[model samples]
Target: MTRRSCPCGLPETYEACCGRFHSGAAAAPTAERLMRSRYCAFVKGDAAYLLRTWHPRTRPATLEPDPGTRWTGLEILDTRDGSAFHSTGTVEFRASYRGGSLHERSRFERVDGAWVYVDGDFLS
Candidate 1:
Protein backbone atom coordinates (compact mmCIF):
# COMPACT_ATOMS: atom_id res chain seq x y z
CA MET A 1 0.00 0.00 0.00
CA THR A 2 1.22 3.47 -0.81
CA ARG A 3 1.46 6.03 1.95
CA ARG A 4 -0.48 9.14 1.15
CA SER A 5 1.16 12.41 2.08
CA CYS A 6 -0.72 14.96 4.14
CA PRO A 7 -2.33 17.89 2.33
CA CYS A 8 -0.70 20.22 4.84
CA GLY A 9 2.63 19.63 3.03
CA LEU A 10 3.99 17.46 5.84
CA PRO A 11 6.09 14.48 4.93
CA GLU A 12 4.03 12.18 7.10
CA THR A 13 0.83 10.55 6.00
CA TYR A 14 -2.47 12.35 6.55
CA GLU A 15 -3.48 9.86 9.22
CA ALA A 16 -0.34 10.53 11.23
CA CYS A 17 -0.34 14.27 10.70
CA CYS A 18 -3.75 15.93 10.52
CA GLY A 19 -6.22 13.09 10.12
CA ARG A 20 -5.88 12.16 13.78
CA PHE A 21 -6.96 15.63 14.76
CA HIS A 22 -9.85 15.53 12.31
CA SER A 23 -11.00 12.22 13.73
CA GLY A 24 -10.86 13.55 17.30
CA ALA A 25 -8.31 10.90 18.11
CA ALA A 26 -5.97 13.68 19.14
CA ALA A 27 -5.94 17.41 19.68
CA ALA A 28 -3.32 19.64 18.17
CA PRO A 29 -0.54 20.15 20.66
CA THR A 30 0.47 23.61 19.47
CA ALA A 31 -0.73 26.52 17.44
CA GLU A 32 1.32 25.55 14.41
CA ARG A 33 -0.13 22.06 14.49
CA LEU A 34 -3.61 23.43 14.72
CA MET A 35 -2.96 25.76 11.83
CA ARG A 36 -1.60 22.90 9.78
CA SER A 37 -4.58 20.72 10.60
CA ARG A 38 -6.95 23.52 9.74
CA TYR A 39 -5.29 23.90 6.37
CA CYS A 40 -5.65 20.19 5.85
CA ALA A 41 -9.30 20.48 6.75
CA PHE A 42 -9.73 23.16 4.11
CA VAL A 43 -8.13 20.99 1.49
CA LYS A 44 -10.37 18.10 2.42
CA GLY A 45 -13.48 20.27 2.78
CA ASP A 46 -14.03 19.07 6.32
CA ALA A 47 -16.24 21.90 7.51
CA ALA A 48 -17.26 20.10 10.70
CA TYR A 49 -13.67 19.75 11.81
CA LEU A 50 -13.02 23.39 11.00
CA LEU A 51 -15.98 24.59 13.06
CA ARG A 52 -15.11 22.29 15.95
CA THR A 53 -11.64 23.72 16.13
CA TRP A 54 -12.75 27.30 15.81
CA HIS A 55 -13.19 29.57 18.78
CA PRO A 56 -16.87 29.82 19.65
CA ARG A 57 -16.79 33.59 19.69
CA THR A 58 -15.47 33.67 16.16
CA ARG A 59 -16.91 30.53 14.64
CA PRO A 60 -19.49 31.09 11.96
CA ALA A 61 -22.96 29.57 11.96
CA THR A 62 -22.05 27.62 8.85
CA LEU A 63 -19.11 26.90 6.55
CA GLU A 64 -18.85 25.86 2.94
CA PRO A 65 -15.60 25.22 1.13
CA ASP A 66 -15.40 26.73 -2.34
CA PRO A 67 -15.97 23.85 -4.68
CA GLY A 68 -13.95 25.48 -7.43
CA THR A 69 -10.86 26.17 -5.37
CA ARG A 70 -8.04 23.70 -5.27
CA TRP A 71 -5.54 24.10 -2.50
CA THR A 72 -1.97 23.28 -3.46
CA GLY A 73 0.52 23.92 -0.67
CA LEU A 74 1.23 25.37 2.76
CA GLU A 75 4.22 27.27 4.09
CA ILE A 76 4.69 28.30 7.69
CA LEU A 77 6.44 31.63 7.68
CA ASP A 78 6.60 32.42 11.39
CA THR A 79 5.20 31.53 14.78
CA ARG A 80 4.83 33.19 18.16
CA ASP A 81 3.79 31.74 21.50
CA GLY A 82 1.21 28.93 20.64
CA SER A 83 3.06 26.33 22.65
CA ALA A 84 1.96 23.78 25.20
CA PHE A 85 2.43 26.33 27.97
CA HIS A 86 0.88 29.34 26.25
CA SER A 87 -2.82 30.20 26.33
CA THR A 88 -2.64 32.09 23.03
CA GLY A 89 -0.45 32.32 19.95
CA THR A 90 -0.18 33.35 16.33
CA VAL A 91 0.94 31.67 13.13
CA GLU A 92 1.97 33.48 9.96
CA PHE A 93 1.58 31.35 6.92
CA ARG A 94 1.03 31.29 3.17
CA ALA A 95 -1.41 28.82 1.66
CA SER A 96 -1.24 28.42 -2.11
CA TYR A 97 -4.05 27.34 -4.36
CA ARG A 98 -4.57 26.79 -8.02
CA GLY A 99 -4.96 30.42 -9.03
CA GLY A 100 -3.49 32.30 -6.09
CA SER A 101 -2.29 32.22 -2.50
CA LEU A 102 -3.53 33.44 0.85
CA HIS A 103 -1.26 35.08 3.36
CA GLU A 104 -2.48 35.57 6.87
CA ARG A 105 -1.46 35.85 10.47
CA SER A 106 -3.85 33.68 12.43
CA ARG A 107 -4.54 33.77 16.17
CA PHE A 108 -5.21 30.81 18.41
CA GLU A 109 -6.26 30.35 22.01
CA ARG A 110 -6.68 27.54 24.46
CA VAL A 111 -10.29 26.84 25.33
CA ASP A 112 -11.31 24.08 27.68
CA GLY A 113 -7.70 22.95 27.39
CA ALA A 114 -7.86 22.69 23.61
CA TRP A 115 -6.41 25.01 21.03
CA VAL A 116 -9.03 26.78 18.94
CA TYR A 117 -8.65 29.26 16.10
CA VAL A 118 -9.72 32.78 16.91
CA ASP A 119 -9.31 35.05 13.91
CA GLY A 120 -6.75 36.31 11.44
CA ASP A 121 -5.51 39.38 9.62
CA PHE A 122 -4.90 38.92 5.96
CA LEU A 123 -1.51 40.10 4.84
CA SER A 124 -0.43 41.62 1.58
Candidate 2:
Protein backbone atom coordinates (compact mmCIF):
# COMPACT_ATOMS: atom_id res chain seq x y z
CA MET A 1 0.00 0.00 0.00
CA THR A 2 1.14 3.51 -0.69
CA ARG A 3 1.77 5.69 2.31
CA ARG A 4 -0.05 8.94 2.43
CA SER A 5 2.16 11.94 3.05
CA CYS A 6 1.38 13.96 6.14
CA PRO A 7 -0.34 17.24 5.53
CA CYS A 8 2.23 18.79 7.86
CA GLY A 9 4.81 18.34 5.07
CA LEU A 10 6.78 15.82 7.09
CA PRO A 11 8.50 12.99 5.29
CA GLU A 12 6.63 10.48 7.37
CA THR A 13 3.20 9.21 6.45
CA TYR A 14 0.10 10.91 7.79
CA GLU A 15 -0.46 7.92 10.07
CA ALA A 16 2.96 8.39 11.59
CA CYS A 17 3.15 12.14 11.78
CA CYS A 18 -0.03 14.09 12.56
CA GLY A 19 -2.53 11.28 12.34
CA ARG A 20 -1.52 9.95 15.73
CA PHE A 21 -2.64 13.19 17.30
CA HIS A 22 -5.84 13.18 15.29
CA SER A 23 -6.56 9.63 16.34
CA GLY A 24 -6.07 10.43 20.04
CA ALA A 25 -3.24 7.90 20.17
CA ALA A 26 -0.80 10.66 21.08
CA ALA A 27 -0.62 14.33 21.92
CA ALA A 28 1.46 17.01 20.22
CA PRO A 29 4.58 17.64 22.24
CA THR A 30 5.29 21.13 20.95
CA ALA A 31 3.56 24.19 19.63
CA GLU A 32 4.74 23.55 16.10
CA ARG A 33 3.48 20.01 16.20
CA LEU A 34 0.12 21.20 17.44
CA MET A 35 0.02 23.81 14.73
CA ARG A 36 0.88 21.27 12.07
CA SER A 37 -1.62 18.72 13.28
CA ARG A 38 -4.28 21.39 13.45
CA TYR A 39 -3.58 22.17 9.83
CA CYS A 40 -3.95 18.51 9.00
CA ALA A 41 -7.27 18.52 10.77
CA PHE A 42 -8.34 21.51 8.74
CA VAL A 43 -7.45 19.71 5.53
CA LYS A 44 -9.40 16.69 6.62
CA GLY A 45 -12.26 18.85 7.82
CA ASP A 46 -12.08 17.43 11.31
CA ALA A 47 -13.43 20.36 13.27
CA ALA A 48 -13.93 18.21 16.35
CA TYR A 49 -10.21 17.58 16.55
CA LEU A 50 -9.51 21.25 16.08
CA LEU A 51 -11.87 22.18 18.90
CA ARG A 52 -10.52 19.35 21.02
CA THR A 53 -7.01 20.74 20.89
CA TRP A 54 -7.96 24.37 21.32
CA HIS A 55 -7.35 26.14 24.61
CA PRO A 56 -10.60 26.16 26.49
CA ARG A 57 -10.34 29.82 27.26
CA THR A 58 -10.24 30.72 23.60
CA ARG A 59 -12.20 27.84 22.10
CA PRO A 60 -15.36 28.93 20.45
CA ALA A 61 -18.66 27.13 20.91
CA THR A 62 -18.19 25.60 17.46
CA LEU A 63 -15.94 25.41 14.40
CA GLU A 64 -16.83 24.90 10.76
CA PRO A 65 -13.96 24.39 8.32
CA ASP A 66 -14.56 25.54 4.77
CA PRO A 67 -14.93 22.36 2.79
CA GLY A 68 -14.75 24.19 -0.50
CA THR A 69 -11.23 25.33 0.26
CA ARG A 70 -8.42 23.04 -0.79
CA TRP A 71 -5.28 23.28 1.27
CA THR A 72 -2.14 23.62 -0.84
CA GLY A 73 0.87 24.00 1.40
CA LEU A 74 2.21 24.97 4.81
CA GLU A 75 5.22 27.13 5.44
CA ILE A 76 6.54 27.61 8.94
CA LEU A 77 8.24 30.93 9.38
CA ASP A 78 9.38 30.89 13.01
CA THR A 79 8.90 29.48 16.47
CA ARG A 80 9.42 30.58 20.08
CA ASP A 81 9.36 28.45 23.21
CA GLY A 82 6.97 25.48 22.60
CA SER A 83 9.47 22.95 23.77
CA ALA A 84 8.39 19.94 25.82
CA PHE A 85 9.56 21.64 29.01
CA HIS A 86 7.94 24.95 28.17
CA SER A 87 4.36 25.73 29.13
CA THR A 88 3.82 28.20 26.32
CA GLY A 89 4.98 29.05 22.82
CA THR A 90 4.15 30.53 19.44
CA VAL A 91 4.37 29.49 15.80
CA GLU A 92 4.24 31.72 12.76
CA PHE A 93 3.23 30.18 9.50
CA ARG A 94 1.72 30.78 6.08
CA ALA A 95 -0.89 28.29 4.97
CA SER A 96 -1.99 28.20 1.35
CA TYR A 97 -5.60 27.44 0.60
CA ARG A 98 -7.45 27.26 -2.69
CA GLY A 99 -9.29 30.59 -2.66
CA GLY A 100 -6.46 32.46 -0.94
CA SER A 101 -3.96 32.04 1.84
CA LEU A 102 -3.29 33.15 5.39
CA HIS A 103 -0.29 34.13 7.44
CA GLU A 104 -0.61 34.11 11.18
CA ARG A 105 1.28 34.01 14.41
CA SER A 106 -0.38 31.45 16.62
CA ARG A 107 -0.11 31.06 20.37
CA PHE A 108 -0.08 27.77 22.22
CA GLU A 109 -0.03 26.64 25.83
CA ARG A 110 0.26 23.40 27.71
CA VAL A 111 -3.13 22.52 29.11
CA ASP A 112 -3.51 19.54 31.43
CA GLY A 113 -0.38 17.91 30.00
CA ALA A 114 -1.13 18.63 26.35
CA TRP A 115 -0.32 21.44 23.99
CA VAL A 116 -3.46 23.36 23.09
CA TYR A 117 -3.94 26.22 20.64
CA VAL A 118 -4.77 29.54 22.27
CA ASP A 119 -5.32 32.11 19.56
CA GLY A 120 -3.66 33.87 16.65
CA ASP A 121 -2.96 37.18 14.93
CA PHE A 122 -3.30 37.41 11.18
CA LEU A 123 -0.40 38.99 9.41
CA SER A 124 -0.94 41.61 6.70
Top candidate (TM-score): 1
Q: What is the lDDT of residue 39 in candidate 2?
A: 93
Q: Lowest summed-lDDT stretch of 10 residues in model 2? A: 2-11
The clash number for model 1 is 0
| Residue-by-residue lDDT tens digits, candidate 1, 29-50 | 9999999999999999999999
Off by over 4 Å in 2: none
Global lDDT of each model? Answer: 0.97, 0.95
Best by lDDT: 1
lDDT of 2: 0.95
> How well does candidate 1 score on lDDT at residue 71?
98
Runs of candidate 1 with Cα error greater than 4 angstroms are none
